[model samples]
Target: DIYAYGSTFRGGEVGVVIVNSGSSAHEISIGGLAVAVKAMGWLVTSNETSSSDPLSARGVMWNGQSSPQSFPLLSLGAYSASLSDDGVLIELPPYSAAGLVVYF
Candidate 1:
């Protein structure tokens, strides 16, 4: 099961998601709602890990993918205008938890 919680402000939104299952990865979509995302942090239950490594998580795409071609995990921040209609896709590892802060 996937659990999510957050709030929206005049400038942006913030929230957290919990991935209960441990088999497949999950993706979240935020489309046509914002212009960019400032940052994100992740904590994997199985890995017992959580980090916001800027070097490794330069940014994220709307398609649930990360930028810099490789930095997509542990951190998130993307400032662009080519987001997909599918929205801002947030990749969630198995049995993990994440927090997101999006900007407009």
Candidate 2:
């Protein structure tokens, strides 16, 4: 299953959250933007089999620190897209979540 939530700021910035809860991956397309901008996302997942264990996220440096081995801030690339006619596409992995932001 896939869940998405989006919000638009007064200044026209866009923030989106996409979550995939199932055991498979999916491709999602988003539209409605005035201009195209760089889109970035982080991959979050859990390593523990127990439900009580907390989840961890990778991609993008944290606290302005450069930990290339830790969080290798990733470009959306194949997982995300910029299309003609102001559209965005995203690929979500199973049991993962992406917090997407786009500037107009």
How many clashes show up per model?
3, 1
Off by over 4 Å in 1: 9-12, 36-39, 48-86
How does candidate 2 fare on TM-score? 0.59
| Model 2, global lDDT | 0.60
* Model 1, span 1-104: residue lDDT tens: 67877776665555445444544577766566445534444444442223333223333333244233454433444323334445566677655556555554
Models 1 onward score TM values of 0.46, 0.59
RMSD of 1: 9.6
- Candidate with top lDDT is 2
Per-residue lDDT of candidate 2, residues 1-104 (tens digit): 88888888797778888888777788887777546665655555444323442234333322222334532345223234454665776667556677777765
Model 2 worst lDDT run, 10 consecutive residues? 57-66
Clashing pairs in 1: 30-88, 59-77, 64-89
